[model samples]
Target: MGSAVRIARETTEQVLAEWGVGPQEPCTGPVLLILSELVANSVRHAAVLSPKVTVIFAGGPDAFAFGVHDRHPYRPALYSPAVAGSGRGLATVMELTLELGGSAVVRGDADEGGKSIWVTLPLRRSGAPGAR
Candidate 1:
């Protein structure tokens, strides 16, 4: 899972760079963290015989969208953050997305028996009304 997290972080960094976003951006760290959590959760809870997890990253001039797909039908479990160390992945993703003026969503593929969890983070461009 550590390797998975590292790979996710590196991939996310590359994507952000390609999209003209810098590592110093306020949303960069949280976006990387969110990617790590999504990959870790898929590995921990959605593994199967092959245990395939696919990560997708897409960014437009205005926002970035990240997604993780796994070969299982399990939906992410949501829990109170007060709980110790368990069930905080999705919660953290949601919190960070909201802080970045974005959103998170989970979709289950009934026909394919798998799921994809996604988050969108808005970009605060220079000179925009709410730029930061």
Candidate 2:
């Protein structure tokens, strides 16, 4: 678990750097933390027969989207964040996404053998929480 967290944090920082997220921007911490949590979820409970977790980090001129595809196809549910530890990972993701002016979603292919959880973070400040 500690190793996974380290890998996830390092990978996330590298990804954010690649995405051109500036040091002046507040998205760095939130994005990295969100990425870590999502990756942690996969490592902890995705029923991955293999330990490989595929992470995708993409950014355009306006938005950035981070995705992690795991082995299991069971989509996580949106539960109350106040439920003490029921679904804290996804909840933390939601909070971080909100802070980053983004959104997080979990989708799974029951027909297939995998699931992907994604968060799209916008680049511009106008796309942020109170932006019009």
Candidate 3:
């Protein structure tokens, strides 16, 4: 699980760097942290039902998005009482994303089962209004 988190972070960093988003960029830190929390949630909650998890990342000039997917059939709400013991990871993910002017959604695979939680955030310049 730790290795999974590490790999997710490293891969996301590399991809962002390749996209010309530097480590010190305003969106980079929150993006990485959100990815980490999503990946960790999948590992801790869905790993038993889904042995493998996938991380998907996409970005462009305006905004960047990523999703964490698992084969488990359960699709968790962004803020639900059912997710009590899972810690505050998802809550933190939501808070940080919204603070950065972003959005999140959970999509379930109708045919195959499982779900993917995706988050998208605008790429704001350091001095831009609302940049964090």
Candidate 4:
């Protein structure tokens, strides 16, 4: 989990820099947090043997999308805070995604026997085209 988190953070930083977004940019922190949660979840609940996790980062002129694919077919579940460590991962990802004027989705591919969670955030306050 720690290694995965570090890789995700480094990848996000590289991407943001490549996008010409400075490290102090407002979205950098939330984006790193979101990536950590998603990657951690993959390591914790979605691992199969060696645990295969694939992360992708892509962006348009005004929005960026990040996703993590794991080798677990089960759909992620959301737990109330009272449930202890049960629900925070997906919930935090969703909350931060919305806070950034973005949204999240998780899909399980039966054929592949795994799932991927994705979040999309706007690049600017004016909003990204087709962002919801």
Best by TM-score: 3
Cα TM-score per model: 0.84, 0.76, 0.90, 0.82
Model 4 alpha-carbon drift over 4 Å, by segment: 77-85, 110-112, 125-132
Tens-digit per-residue lDDT, 1-132, candidate 3: 899999999999999888888788888888989999999989999989998989998888879999999999888778666455567888888778888889999999987589999999998757766665
In terms of lDDT, the poorest run of 10 residues in model 4 is: 123-132
RMSD list, candidates in order: 2.8, 3.7, 1.9, 3.9
Q: Per the 3 Å backbone cut-off, how many clashing residue pairs does candidate 2 have?
A: 0
Residue-level lDDT tens digits of model 4 in 30-107 = 888888888888888767642778988989767788988887777665333542466666777777777778877777
lDDT of 4 at 11: 82
Ordering by TM-score? 3, 1, 4, 2
Residue 63, candidate 4: Cα error in Å is 0.6
In model 2, what are the clashing residue pairs, if there are any? none
Candidates 1 and 2 compared by lDDT, better number: 1
TM-score of 3: 0.90
lDDT of 4: 0.76
Query: Which one wins on lDDT?
Result: 3
List, residue by residue over 1-132, the lDDT tens digit for candidate 2: 667778877877776667676545666666777878878878888645637788877788677787888878667764454533666777777766776668777777576678788889876533466433
- Regarding lDDT, does 3 or 4 come out ahead? 3
C-alpha RMSD between model 2 and the true structure: 3.7
Position 14, candidate 4: lDDT? 94
